[model samples]
Target: MSERANAMRASILRSHGGPEVLRLSELPAPVPTSGETLIRVGAAGVEPGLDVRTRLNGAGWQLRFPHVLGASMAGTVISSPDAAAPDPGTRVAVAPNISCGECAYCRSGRDNSCAQREFLGIHHAGGYAEFCSVPTRNLIPIADSTSFAVAASTAVSFGTAWHLLVTRARVSPADVVFVVGAAGSVGTAAAQIAALFGARVVLGSRTPQNLRELSDEVRALGVVDTTTDFAPQLESIAPGGVDVVVETVGSDTWAGSVDSLAPEGRLVCCGGASGGEVGLTLRDLYRRNLSLLFSTSSTFEDLRLVLRLVDEGRLRPRVDKVFDLADAAAAHAAVEAGGLQGKVVIVPESAA
Candidate 1:
């Protein structure tokens, strides 16, 4: 390979402030270390909570300068040292979380809680480049029929939703599930997953048009306009209250989520994009017997399950927009701007 072939284009984050901090630059392609695989990135998904927030405030993760910041990505393997890894030319989606398989959490299938867990983009160089060196274990082979954009958009959103609804909330046909902030990537996945489990899904959003469109698409039981007070609207939609509340908006929708929950309802939270701080009424919580559960990233198994679902057409991954790797700053700006109903993806110029 020539010297130019060894170099790759990437969106480098030199300082934490705004989207402008992400600049296009050329850097040496990552060399695969032992137990790692090198892949040519086809598409990378922008995660608002991880990518935008970390770019704006650093998110307290230790970082080296000129970092890459894509949480989820999919591509074709170029080379691998691990025998278990997919062969060269195989398409795959890279799992975002890296956990120690020896940990108790990992053995018990709660790898998301493994103490030694590290995340792409946050703890290390991720997929904001033309190529990435990924842990061999994190590469999940994707079907040839799966579009790179859809595969790239799957891991974080659908995986997290699967963990939240299936593992944490235990949603079922008997339950009425409410997905807050239904327009975002995770929210859309959560609503679809809930419906897949035969639950009556209700989608809540500040944008009525988006909410209605998503509700119809997901075959949700109803739609709740959350622009103003939504508790009453939720009541009108779900009689007493929903059995399961998928809460991702955090403080912005916390109280309303609690208010819309039925007695002994399970409220599972995975993100706090608006803000983290929220006031809780202890008395109301005890009287209603509400269960407040929190989840982080998903396990490798969760990622696999969602990927299979997406590939089988049981669950759909939404890509709102696709930007070239050189336009990563614009992608981040779009994520930070809000009101997007699907994921914004960044792809290498060649892939674009």
Candidate 2:
């Protein structure tokens, strides 16, 4: 209906390989279908697993080439065909996971496990552009006190972290929670949520600076410690081992996470941003009485709670840096570089 509504600038991935595959181009703006809404994207987080995993190796999802790649996005709703949806101009955080509402899992409050679930960036077009369309059910309202970048940073990191520690593992005050990749966004969020529930947190990261910074932040919130040397340091500090371990580095930390857990401990894993495959033994698992759980992406209710915590000033997701939408290649390069203590956000040039 408006000039900006006609066409938009977007980072298009014509073919998947590396950051070099991302190209800045003009594309037709997406129009909202009957139950969908068109958002003018303000900021989107460049997540490695969503972008790289899906882009490089397809990440178990069937592909459509020339796709836009971004999962964590926040923006203003410019058009909503659904009369009962939030009014146009409402600032909202995008919930990028779609699930079949009629599924048994969906009706049972386990939408994350809905058999017919699809991720936004992976299954369809997502927020690496100026304007994008999504189902109205995916929008999470944001407060004026929240910045678009901050809101965009939370849904993925905090939602997954909250679900893993709070819902899956059921971390408690007496539990000692160990978070791998503590400098990364998900790791940091996991540590924070664990601390919020009164758990003793042990943060592990290879980067000295990331460990230092995250350790400081967690210590400020509750009892916590950081380690650059994961297994050895964990053994020395927590001699008896921890009750819960949150691992995202996958193959890199899999063995160590198993070794660091206490008897009957719970180990929750969401992603393997580092490497996927890892060796495991059935005898070791049964003997140790350890429970290994895999957490998929979080639910809408999880996203809502994360937003509420952020809005209330209890949880904070790191925004390491921001890149203009046109500079998506550089953003991907930074993500690939690793050792970052926060999320790398891409702001639409129109918004920037």
Best by lDDT: 1
lDDT of 2 by residue, 241-350 (tens): 88998998888678888988899999999988668889988888899899999998799999998999998989988888899998899999998888687889999978
Q: What is the C-alpha lDDT of each candidate?
A: 0.89, 0.85
Task: Output the worst ten-in-a-row residue range by lDDT, candidate 2.
Answer: 220-229
What C-alpha root-mean-square deviation, in Å, does candidate 1 show against the real structure?
1.3
TM-scores of all models?
Answer: 0.97, 0.95
Which 10 consecutive positions of candidate 1 have the poorest summed lDDT? 1-10
Top-TM-score structure, candidate number: 1
Clashes (backbone N, CA, C under 3 Å), per candidate, total: 0, 0
lDDT of 1 by residue, 228-294 (tens): 8888888788888989999988888899999888999999999787889999989999998989999
Residue 322 Cα positional deviation in candidate 2, in Å, after optimal superposition: 0.3
CA lDDT, candidate 1, residue 193: 94
